[model samples]
Target chain A: MLTSAAKTALYGAHVSLGAKMSPFGGFLMPIVYTSILDEHKAVRTAAGLFDLSHMGQLVARGPAVAEWLDRLTVNRVAGMREGQARYNIFTNERGGAHDDAILYRFPEDWLIVVNAANTAKMWELLQASKPAQVALENRTPQSALIAIQGPRAAEILAPLCGADLDGLRSYHALRTRLADGAGGVEVEIARTGYTGEDGFEIFLPAGAAPAVWERLLVAGTTHGLRPAGLGARDVLRLEAGMPLYGHELDEDITPLQAGLGWAVRWEKSDFIGKTALAAQKAADDYDRIVGVVMDGKAPARAGYAVHADGRRVGEVRSGSIAPALGGRNIATALVAKAASAPGTRLTIEIRGTEHPATVVPLPFYKRPA
Target chain B: MSQPADRFYTKEHEWVKIEGQTATVGITDYAQSSLGDIVYVELPAPGAALERGKPLGVVESVKAVSDIYAPLPGTVAEVNAAVEDDPALVNRDPFGEGWLIKVSLTGDASPDGLLDAAAYAEFVRSL
Candidate 1:
């Protein structure tokens, strides 16, 4: 029990053995000052602050910025508006997903926040694979990221950052100040989040993050912002039916096969893998991605087999208990063409047992109005 | 709290109580807390051989799937069926109704390979 020291120590009271807890992302973090379920429920109802400093950010600059990026990514980055952000995929020439990124364009350079797990590999790929003219630098060491997300997120962040965030619209970003400083590093706050809840990803120097974290926690306590960890982050994204990169989209799978074809700018005249993408589109034989809602008590997990007529049809790529949509099991699976349609009945193998399931439209959950 | 002083513990985080040759086994409090909420537990059959340190059954929580290792080698076991239905039994009564199975001790229920409450407490502390 984490509460072990509190009841035992008399002066451990003053010097309570604050837990050195290690958890998600290979870091020991606090599970809760309270409980896991309580922290999970808070984000569903109100707002929560998460230390997402582990996520990686890369800056791309130099002469072939537009031309090289447009070629390297599946999405259209060349036509991106200033201060706007877009979710795009970096892929191999074979069209497999190398990384899923949020591309941010500023006046000086373009920044892409990538999943932390892919940081090293993505850097190596960019150095070896991206055009010779594009200069890609890993800026993760210098910055930290924070997510203040949920229904009241905008309201909480608005007064502190002092930017017209309401008018900023979704997927927009701007350079904003915390305490009015001109001689030092600046913070760039973006309206981006891994959680489906509306939120902002505030970027600042790594050394200055703890102060901001403390301030936000103090400022947010009045607004019911609990300090949530990666556990709640997993549940939130699962409920929102968002796909995690390693789980849903991987190096072996193409974005088109993962139901992200709409993001590929085929209308653009040229891009990397354009010839292969065109051929795949012409073939149209890809086994597409779809959502599966389980019909039994079991939670489907990664590598669990998806079944059709007692035969293994596919495997669950990512699965979890959907917190927002009650306690039912939800999964994203890559099933065959016929079974990929909504309303198609399927089965999920949990452990050794097969439970009835069905193909549903993407996103088993959506934000309430 | 540290491991209860009166209880004996297996290295795999299982705690046991033996009366005669029949021994009761359940996950330690530290195990349940680490596994988060216990969502499902697979209990062994009434007459199956289980070797010490070998997996006797499976326990799936919201966070991870764990192999419930045999506390002591034995044969033919009675299971706690309640956990199969309401798996939270491990969280609620980890030492009582939360017991996974009763095993008939095989070799020595010897003290050498096991940990006392003080040692288990120290071991968990090091973790």
Candidate 2:
């Protein structure tokens, strides 16, 4: 199955670390190094390193870049200041999400980080919709992204990074150099992450990734920075209430339906899917995503039926044991608005039996300030 | 890890130690290791009938779930409360504390069709 999948520069390092390899987003990715629970706890408590090179990096330049992109996505792109990053979503004609992305504004260009699975689709869409003044480049293959996440992440990275780590605010990015053995490599350090913790995502050339990875590992030994994999990443993101691409947002699921109305800028003059999104927002009766906490020990899985009042209401979109929640099972389910209230009672059908579950708030976990 | 020579094993990685009319059943070490950090276990209740090669319970890890199969036809005499309460026991000691159920042997309860320890070790290698 992995014969045709592409591998990142850190693939050999992962194999040497005895990571369990699996095919994800057309790439041979590490699912776990030691244990998912251990890695998940490390990210929550101390620090965790991630090889996120599989995510797509698209660069857009030219004077009309922001304006052009603003018309394509649901968020306001042109209003973003340089060195700022914003979460946005590209929607289709029906206001359904094409993909959720993070847009980083630079002095001369814009960097859009997209989901790995949507790389090809987003690239095609951007190329097809490009105006004469916009220059679009798919830099995914040439770029590598490494994220250090946890409460102690900044402490672990401060000694090696040349940037003012203390001054960098959240949702911001700065071009800086990271010291390697021979001089250093130019990198973009972004104080942003999906793990709902204080962290930084470093982007650099693919060729320099391995050395930087090794250096970070060596420097992070005292802070308990273990190389985490996709399994832990999924659990961390889910607990943080972040919307995963295929689960919460998809071609058929709009941002509003996925509880991402905060990202949609209604004041934007014109954008793709604006009409449909406005209609849905105005109607406010669509089936939507909600958090479900299982009252029993059984973990609700994706595609499991959800019931309310003895009738099928929705289905589980994602589920996992939230180690942050003291091993309680948590899930995201798309259900009718009537069943989406915070205190609503629901049942998740696991094999042939329905287990009791209750609707709660979006995030099942939050780090201490 | 090597299988215990005193018991019999099935192709599905379940081991059974037949003692008189009773049999003690649990998953092999290879099975627990492959499953990875079991978080929950579902075993057949006491007095439940189990057919050979049929699913008797489930073992769930953080990312996946697998069904544990019966190695011999029998009625469940007792279920392991230790494993059900703390699933990590299956990963720590699959052969001892993680035993799933104690069964009262039923029809054709002889271990004639099961693989002996030497044969079972060879079978695992072939996999």
Candidate 3:
């Protein structure tokens, strides 16, 4: 069964129109909006607006909130100033990544947005980790996030929010009142996006989101904004060299091997999985993530085996023939050093047929002008 | 968008433009619309023998990979190279510049089995 939460990753999910429905992140999300290629192009050449309301939102406060958060997360939270956000990780004691989150620091507290499927578990962990003075609350039902992304996204969204958008930069957010009597809503416009374009993610009240979206659609028509689904979002993020949670990193993949070591605060006084990560970093038998380009027409979608010569070398983590890259089969995979070099020759078994493949640098497509 | 009257189509949406023993091949407008923004096509090599209704090639869209079927039996005499370079041509010109392959027909190339423009339009509407 596809729930509302399953719909975020690939927008257009759970539409009553009988499109192929797949359960993703606890919601039913669309793999294609009309068609994957068209949607992808809309984002690449024009602009794409995605409904990312299904991501988890949590509020933690009190004296122990900060301290408890520091003990639980991989990234150091002590340095976060008000109105700032930082990417952090939830890790197991063995150093494997459980999930990733964005920590938004408020003047007196913090809002941690996490993956939909991981929300309950993360909340439970916080419940156990919170000190006597701390309080944790899950606010997923109250918030809806909409992303307006592409080269011309800013120009399209400026009038609606009436913020100083010209000076707005990436990773920065501004909270402001939305339309009058607009369902008791307040919107936080973040100059952040998943499509690797200049765009914004607007966070508003769940009830108010639809109205704001409608207004944006009317306002964004001149800029060619499309209501893109999750399918296009994946291709765009992959093209930009960003990683997906389940595809690139999971409970089995550590932050170090996933090329997310930069997010780990090694110098922090103490944090979960720090010792294990330190030990893993000292040794090397595990694989690291990198891009792969397969030859010929057949693309190696997820769950395909990577082969060196005729033997299994590794597994394809994420795979797609990107639209912007002119239909070349590209992927990210973790493999042993013998098979992980940039120029290493390999093959991917697609439907029992072996397609010629090669290891390439991360990101198959650069930002198009 | 066109559905040339004299051509036959497969359930997979391939169109065969027949002329005596020679039949030009391309995907239908419906197929093009369904596939959307063709990025790369793996066409069967020239002179490769293909059976009717069999997998002849593959098409990669931005989001998914789809297989192409041979609409009629014959050998591939020519494959569109322009599309290999610029797959968007398939979306822009599905009938002319977007044509995929040319095959030499062995025997039957049915005109009765194919839909006229009106019929194809109805087929699309029904879909």
Candidate 4:
């Protein structure tokens, strides 16, 4: 089965570690090394390493690179300073999301990290809308991304990194050297993560990934760093109130409906989906995403019907057992505005039985300051 | 982990330990491992009738929900409350403290369709 899927440079390493390999985003990726619960706890309490090579990395360079991207995405890309990373979303003409992405501004070029599943689509979109001046390149196949996430991330990475780890702020990036055995490997380190933790994501050549991964593992062993997988990553993102591409923000779901209006720059002169998004904002009656906590042991699941006052209102987009919330079942549902208020009683229909759930605020878990 | 030699297994990865007219049922270790972390378990109440190869309850992990099937025809005599309270027991001790249900075998009940320990191990390997 793995033969049909693309393998990362760490494929052999993951196999040797007895990781459960599964297909994700067109790649044969590790789903878990030991158990999801153990890995999730490791990321929360200590630190966890992740193979993010499957994500897409697109590089664009030109004088009008940021300006052209500003017209295509829903955020202010042109105003971004060098070494800054901003979360942005590409939307369709109808205000539907094409993909949620992070744009990292460099001195000479911009690196856009997109969802792996949307890599092909995003590349086509960029090329079709590209002007004569902007040059676009897909670096995903040649690049590998590794992320060390959690409270001990900086402590584990400071010794190996040449850049000032303590000085790096969140959503900032720097091109630096990672200490290898004899020489240094040039890499880009970004202090951004989907897990809502203090972390750093390293982007480097694919050939350099395995060695870096092993080096980090060796250095992090005493710090309780474990190799987490996609299963744990999914749980962590959900607990952090982050959105997954297919679940929370798809082609039919807009940034406004997903509670990401802040990512949408309405003040921008002109962008795709501006008109429709403006109308949706004016109406303010669109069905929106809300956080839910089930009152029973049965966990809510994606596509489960959500009902309020005996009427079908929405369906769950993503659901999982939230370890941060003490093993309680949590979910995100796209429901009508009337049912989106916090403390609103809602019911999730599971296997023809209605289970009690309450509408709470987004972000089921928050890191202590 | 090795399957208990005294039990009969099903193709769906369920194990049944039969003694006299009573049978204890639980999922195999492979099933629990494949399901990852177990967070919830729903079972039938005592006195519910179950047929062979029929859905009995659900076992939910953080990522997925799997249906647990009955191994033989029986009347549910008791349910394991420990698992419903702490579902991780199914992942920790799947055969012992994680036993899902105990059933009184029906009059026509038979283990004809079930496989023994060796056969079940081979079946798992074939997968």
TM-score of chain A of 4: 0.99
Best candidate according to DockQ? 4
Whose TM-score is greatest here?
Answer: 4
Tens-digit lDDT track for model 3 on A5-62? 4334223323642344456667665555566666677777778777777778888888
Scored against the true structure, residue A355 in model 2 reaches a CA lDDT of 94
Better of 1 and 3 by lDDT: 3
B1-127: candidate 4 lDDT, tens digit per residue: 6999999999888999999999999999999999998999999999999998999999998888899899999999999999999999999999999999999999677889799999999999999
lDDT of 1 by residue, A1-369 (tens): 342211111112112323224443333444443445556677777788877666778888876777777877889988988798999988777788888889998877888888877887878877886677777888776677778888888777787776788887788888877742333337888888877878888888877676676677778788888877666677678677676888878787788888888889887777667787788888988777788898876778888888887777788887777766677778889887767889889988776777899888877777787
lDDT of 2 by residue, A9-86 (tens): 899999999998988998899999988999999999999999999999999989988888888899999899999999
Residue A231 lDDT (model 1): 65
Cα lDDT tens digits, model 4, A102-219, are 9999999999999999999999999999889999999999999999999999999999989899999999999999987759799999999988788999999998999999999999
TM-score of each: 0.86, 0.97, 0.81, 0.99
Candidate 3, position A365, lDDT: 75
Docking class of 1: acceptable
What local distance difference test score does each model get? Answer: 0.76, 0.93, 0.77, 0.94
Give all candidate RMSDs, comma-separated. Answer: 5.7, 1.4, 4.4, 1.1
Regions more than 4 Å wrong, model 3: A2-47, A117-134, A155-159, A162-169, A180-184, A221-227, A293-300, A308-311, A321-329, A343-360, A363-369, B1-4, B17-24, B105-127
Question: Chain B of candidate 1 versus the native chain B: what TM-score?
Answer: 0.92
Docking class of 3: acceptable
Residue pairs clashing, model 2 = none
